[model samples]
Target: MREVQPVATAHLRRDETGHRRRVRRLPLVAVGALVAATAVALPQFTPDAKAATTLRGYADGRGVKIGAAVGDGPLTSDSGHTAVLDREFNSVTAENAMKWDALEPTRGSFNWAAADRLVAHASAHNQGVRGHTLAWYAQLPSWLKNGNFSASELNTILKGHIGTKVGRYKGKVYAWDVVNEAFSGDGSMRGSLWPTKLGTGYIANALRWAHAADPAANLKRFSDLGLEVSVTELDVRIPLPASSAQQSADYKPASLNPNE
Candidate 1:
C-alpha cells in the first residue's frame, strides 16, 4: 500500500469495449493465485466540488466495486480517513494487518487483534474484506525465517500456517492473495526460502492447504486450482503539480490478457 502520486488502477473486470479482461504480468505458475470473487482497491480520490457521486457510488452504478488498502492505525484513529473509506469504498484490504508478521509475530503464538479489527470495521461498513496474503517471503516472523529446519519440517510449518490463518476467517474473507511477489520482474522464480528449501512445488502445496482450510472462498476459476488473475498494486507516478491531461497521457493502458 505504498502511496504513489497521480493514478492507480484496481483489478479491471472488463474493458470499456465490454470484453472480459484479466491482468497477469507473469504466467500462472506455482506460487501465485488471484481470486476474482472480490474487488480490489481502486484509486483514492479526493473530494471534489464538482463531483456528482462518491467513488463507490460510481463503481456500483457500473456493477463494480471500489476499495482501498486500509491501514489499522489510520482506519481506527483518523476519523477523516475512516470517513472517506466508509463513504467511498465498498471493499477494504488489510494493508499490513493481515501480513504474516503482523498476524503472527512469534511462533505458535498469533495476535489477531489488528486484523480482526479491520475485518469487523469492514463488516460494519458493509464492505468486503480482502485478506492481504497467506504465503509470502517478506514480513515473515523471526522464528519462521531464522529457524533451521529440514525441508519436510518447513513444509509442515507452511501448511500449518496456511490452514490456521485461512481457517480463522474462512467465510469472512472475500479473497486471499494466497502467495505474493513470488516472481521477479523478469518472470523468473524469485529466490526465497520456499524455493531454496521446499522447492518450487511448495507454491502448489500452499494453495492446496489454503483451499482445504476454506474451500468456500476463492472459488473463481481462471486456471488450475480455481485461481484467477489480477493486476496487483497497479500505480502510476507523474511529476508533481501535473495536469489532468498529463496524467491521462502518462497512464496509458497496457494490452493485457491472462490467456496470453
Candidate 2:
C-alpha cells in the first residue's frame, strides 16, 4: 500500500502598498496522496556563482514571471528608470500608448509611433508585452463618443478598431485585456457607452472580433477566450471624518481564497 501524505498550498495577501502581508496555508484534499507517491527527485545542479541579482532574476529562480506597467515618458526620456524596468521585470504593459485615443486620434488615420517604440524596446530586451486594452469607455476621442451613428454603424466601427489594433500586434503581444472594467462594484455591468449603445451583446461581439483578428493570441480557455479581463486600476474611497485607525482598518489587505 502507498503511504498517503498531505500537500500544503499557500495563499498570499497583498496590502494597499503592494507588499506581501501574510500567508495562509491549506492542505489539498484530493490528489495529495497521488502527488506524494509519484514524486521523484532529480539530480540538482548549482547555479552560476555570479548569478543575476535583480528582481527578474529572483523570479526566474522560482519559475515565476514578474511584470510592470510603464508609461511612454519614462521609456523615451528617462534612461535610468528604463534600465531599472528592463532589468527587473520579464513582462511590460503600456500605461496608455495603446488606448483608443492614442492609436486613432482622428478618424480614418492612425498613429503607431509611441506604442511601436515601447514594443520595440520590450522585444529588444526579450520581454513579453501585454496590450493594455481593446475597448474602453474613458479616454476615448471626442469623435467616437459624439459621433452620430446607428447601432449597426457603431458595431462596424468597433469591429474595425479591434481588428486593426489586434491584427497589428498579433504575434508580438502575449496577452490582451480585450475588455476593461465591464462591471461595477455591485457585480452588475457598468453603464459604459458600449452597453448603452450596442447592448450587452456587444461584449461577446468584441471578443469574437478580437479572436477573428488575432487567431494566434495567447488567450485563456476557450470559454474565456477573448474575455481576458484585468483589474488594471483599483481605487478605494473612504468617507471624510474618519480616524487614522479607521482608515488603516479599512485598508486591510484583501484575502484570496485559493480553494475556490
TM-score of each: 0.72, 0.69
Q: Per model, state how many residue pairs clash.
A: 0, 0
Instruction: State each model's C-alpha RMSD to the native.
Output: 12.1, 12.2
Candidate 2, residue 250: the lDDT equals: 59
Q: Mind giving the per-residue lDDT tens digits that candidate 2 earns over 1-260?
A: 22222111111111222321221111111100000101112112222433357766665566444567666777887788788787677667766678888789898789898889988998888776767677676668778989977889999999999899888876777666666656654557778788898997887677777777776543332322222222233347666788987776657665744333
Judged by lDDT against the true structure, how good is candidate 1? Answer: 0.66
Model 1 segments beyond 4 Å from truth?
A: 1-31, 35-52, 218-229, 235-260
The true-structure Cα RMSD of candidate 2 reads 12.2
Stretches > 4 Å off in candidate 2: 1-52, 218-260
Alpha carbon lDDT of each predicted model: 0.66, 0.61
Q: Assess candidate 2 and give its TM-score to the true structure.
A: 0.69
